[model samples]
Target: MAKPQVRYVCQSCGSIQSKWMGQCPDCQGWNTLEQEASQAATPFANKHNLRGGGRRIELASLSSEIEPAPRRPTGMTEFDRVLGGGLVPGCAVLIGGDPGIGKSTILLQAAARIADNGGSVVYISGEEAVDQVRLRADRLGVAQSPVQLGAGTAVRDILTTLESQPAPTLLVIDSIQTLYSDQLEAAPGTVSQVRAASHELIRYAKTSGASLVLVGHVTKDGQIAGPRVLEHMVDTVLYFEGERSHAFRILRAVKNRFGGTDEIGVFEMQEKGLAEVTNPSALFLTDRDRPVAGSVVFAGVEGTRPVLVEMQALVVRVPSGATPRRAVVGWDSSRLSMVLAVLEARCGLAFSGHEVYLNVAGGLRIGEPAADMAVAAALVSALLDRPMPNDLVAYGEIALSGEIRPVSQSAARLKEAAKLGFTRAFVPPRGNSGREIATVEFPTLAALVDHLTDGL
Candidate 1:
């Protein structure tokens, strides 16, 4: 007879404790600890088993055998570009998005492409049956290829099928939360089940030299719906973020062991499917007949991708003395407040009792420091009731001392701006001197104010 094993696991952070606790020690969430069955407490059962462990071999005895990596293209150029060329073998990718965000559609399209490329692909659907998947595929007009569809949600059965198949298979789990392992007595979609299933899929991928993609759900707070450990176990994490009202969707890389974290893929949701946008800048910028106040174009970098985005700001006089509020949507509120302070201190602009609202177009968030100048310029343009010129682009970081600090990848930013036919650019003085644009170099935000006011 086997010994009875007992363990407590946090439903929030996946922290295992020998005994039950009221609060999670790691995340400090209350009542997150739950007891799992004794059979699921095996130390070696839940752990992922990768290669190159427990082998004592000399370095000199190992020969150099590096095979060229073959990337499975998705028939979408922009998607491939953001994936650092293509999906790598033995890699696990986690993609999360809101419900009805076309997460399933995108992966199914990729599976079709993989099959079209002469590669066998298996798509495991936990949310829908095989007939439902086929109906949607036919409705979307997706081509059928060497792709196999499974309707069950059992993790053990999925693993069995994967093991029975040979190499060169691309497996996609519609979601990680729906998979349940029979070895564990916990219910499906529980913290323990999610963690266990993710490990098993990762191990299967590495050992079989196959690429695996897991579609994960997001909570109402926009966080990936699973324990934090699930993210740590995966090789890459991608989040599909966009407003449901908006047609454009942005795929942002949050974690990537093989590539960059800042890479972003842009796609337009269409009736047929998600269409990749080749030139995101043009799509993001509005085609206005004339320059409008509260609008400015920002040159920023998302990983190796250079994106030009539009910033809009509105400054209105406060009706009462209750201290006007600062509201920002899509853009970071803290960063917006910091830029407002710089403008007030350096540019001598009094924004104390005014209600300020800032927005980044296309429903995308800007984390890069290069957007600071554009946000400032847009605020100033709104305050002065004059719009920035259409053919002008701006990017810089405003220091607290009122100096325009240099931003990373200035040269590349200028090149992208020029390629997009922007005739003039306002940049940091130290970094913009040798650039080709009709550059206005400013030592301080005050200098920028003086430069613009002189022409006005």
Candidate 2:
């Protein structure tokens, strides 16, 4: 008999501890620990389980001669771009997002694309029936009935279907949280059930050469739901993030084993479905109808894509003892503070008693240093009561010493800006080769201050 077990496990990381704690040490998450049935008597407790073999292996005998298989395209340009052109056969992908955030729409569209390309796709959804899915497809304008499954659909049925199909197949599980196995007595979405289900699915994907796309749920804090092990077991992880009140959604890659993880796919949510924003810079810059003070254009790079966005800042005198409020939207607050302090120390801006607020015009979050120049310009515009020229753009990083630092791909940034009708640009002196945009090179913050105030 099992020695009647007891222990609390962290739901996030699966770390087991002897006693319950408010915060998990492994994942540093509060209230994530939960009691689980003891594993002492389970088959997993024995190291000899699963193949009934000894665990010892000789490392010297292992061969590194495995050849990698070719990748297949998912059929969506934006989605394909994020996955480094296409999906690798046998690669497991996890996509997480809030409910009704278009996770199912994107995957369905991908399936249709694959089918159009003469590939087979199996889409399993536990949340919706086949008829409901078909209605949604018709509404999205795809209008197709390629493959479908309903709840109570067993994994054995899916495996059999794939075995009979000769074409390359892309399998999509609407959500991993809903899948369960009779082998595991635990309920679905529980730690054991999720892990066991994912393990089996991952194994099936590899052995069958089927590309698997698993949809996951995100927590209130925007992390993938279920144990963190789910993220580690997959080949790629993508998150759908955007304000629900808005109609735009951004799919960003958090982890990619076969490609760069910095890629992001922008989509516009409409009555029809999620439409790809091929030229995001243009879409983001559309609201700028006129040039205004405390507003400037910033050219930044997201992965290999060059983006031109607007930065707006406002400065006002505070009436109370509260430290001047520093509010930020679409950018990091601490980063804004760092830029503000740099401006005060290096450029000698008098902002001791002023309330400052900064924002990136779009709802997108930007982290690149290319935003530095535009941010600085906006702050100065508010300080000097002057607005940056509507047609002007800026891109560079500012050090604490007020020195302008070179940003990546300045030429590409300038080319993108020029395409958007920007005639003038401010850039770091060192990085500016003088071939792009009527360049206004600033060596230091002090020089920039002098240049802007000399004629005032």
Candidate 3:
């Protein structure tokens, strides 16, 4: 037998090295390499394995007809929405989030719902005891659900037990990081163990035709902890995101082989658990009985759904010789800087002596460039102490050349705004003109600035 070889693996990038290093060569992450062992290579192993013993796979034509995969609804609309409909047989989903961000809670709720609907469901927790899980189930009002529960961390034992029983319709592992394979010497949560355990679980899901949901731990930077390949091994990858100070949470699908990516499901954390928000726009919008300076309603789109959110800005003139600070919440600071630069250069606005602050209300983060117009509007309103119309919403991307560009789904945005009693929209040239709401076209940022200053 060949002796075991010692190797160092970078935990951040999953790159293997012969010796320990302070920084990873591939990812440049400092102090991320950890020691692991692998079987030493033998001379016969390399010489004997040349394409003779493997069975050939059958090929199929590209035009072959096939039926759509069947789906099992978990009785949660928001969850299903993020999933691109319902759970498909043998689908593997990986969800990651910060600590105390309700990843386990949502999975438990879904498992219970599936079990209650006459589907066999198994939930294995490596992070908590059976009693602790039961206590949570009781708190979430799902103690009576017929979901089978187990507590274990050894992947071999778990797989053995699962093989002995009939395949369940749904299988949920509380977290993949805690599971360790007996075949590897590395401890759990290491790169090797995570990769081995996930491979085994996903293989079982494929062979047994069970829908699998794996909970994943996230690093401080919000990337899922473990080898990056773990994400590619699964069919879907979801991130549960929200601020601890807020009740609303967003489950976003960043990668999905069976559905559209970038789709989001809105949920609210309550004493009972996570409840779906069917009308997310209502939850994100604030009271608009009166229009206030620095406040503007933004009609944005998340996936296929149209949403309206509030953008607020504050501009304060600092004393001469004092450096001005810029602060932003729930939006990119660099994008704000770009918008400010456009305002200063294209519209003759002076902001070098002012401190600027911008925020997206309701703790919801905006990533689309369509929010540039609304953010620019809010900043101008705050700078000039002018209030925007309460019944107006804005959506348009701004070019560095000061041109207002049209965004995708302009009609959807206008229709959503009209449904919410917004009577006017500030849109780009050739943008959607809805019958229910009047559209004001702004061909350039200078035109918008001029319109705002006209009433001043």
Superior by lDDT: candidate 1 or candidate 2: 1
lDDT of each: 0.84, 0.82, 0.94
Q: Candidate 2: where is the Cα deviation over 4 Å? A: 1-69, 153-168, 434-436
Q: Candidate 2 clashing pairs?
A: 293-387
- Compose the digit string of candidate 2's lDDT tens values, residues 187-211: 8788887888889888988888889
lDDT of 2 at 189: 81
lDDT tens per residue, model 1, 240-296: 988887889988888988777879989999888888887888887888569989898
Q: Per-residue lDDT tens digits of candidate 3, residues 186-221?
A: 999999999999999999999999999999999999
**What TM-scores do the predictions have?**
0.84, 0.81, 0.89
> Which runs of model 3 end up more than 4 angstroms from their true locations?
1-54
Compared with the true structure, model 3 gives a TM-score of: 0.89
Alpha carbon deviation, residue 366, candidate 3 (Å): 1.0
Q: Model 2 Cα displacement at 290 (Å)?
A: 2.8
Best by lDDT: 3
Q: In model 2, which range of ten residues has the least summed lDDT?
A: 145-154
Off by over 4 Å in 1: 1-68, 433-436
